[model samples]
Target: MPPGGRQVLGADLGVVDHAACAGEEPELFFHGDPGAIALAKRICGRCPVREACLARSIANDERYGVFGGLTADERQELQGRRAAA
Candidate 1:
């Protein structure tokens, strides 16, 4: 819900417990470099709440950074594919 796909929440916020990216650098998610993106995706690939993260990303119309392992363009293509399907 914050910029760069990074959220700063207290332990009381349950999302903290399940978000594998919670403590990762926000820049890691927002950087435009290909290597950074790959790393971000790898992190998301193992995340327990990947689908939830993607759903939230699409729901919020996130236009930047990596969310649920997909880049914004990748997410857009995924949406297009779903529509076509």
Candidate 2:
């Protein structure tokens, strides 16, 4: 999938769609709202896909929202810390 979660659908890949960015843009809203983030974090705290989701967010350098229950600024800080280390 593309970094922004956009993907081409169908066998021909000619049609345009956003299925990958669907389902839960909510999942990426932790940066925009603290209360929502807290709620999502509670759920993600126990989700099996948390690691996978976090990995994707970091790889994508997601800058506008949250993923895996982490805010954009938090993810950036993590990246910075890793780079510094």
Q: Report, for every candidate in turn, its global Cα lDDT versus the true structure.
A: 0.82, 0.59
| Cα lDDT of model 1 by residue, 13-83, tens digit | 34545878987998999999999999999999988878778877787789999998999999999999999
The estimated TM-scores of all candidates read 0.81, 0.63
lDDT per residue for candidate 2 within 19-79, as digits (tens), equals 2323455545545566877766666665555655666667666786656657778888888
- What ranges in model 2 sit over 4 Å off? 1-31
**How close to the true structure is residue 61 of candidate 2, measured as C-alpha lDDT?**
67
User: Distance (Å) between predicted and true CA of 46, model 1?
Assistant: 0.8
Per-candidate Cα RMSD to the true structure, in Å, reads 5.1, 7.1
- Using lDDT, give the best candidate's number: 1
Stretches of candidate 1 above 4 Å error?
1-16
Best by TM-score: 1
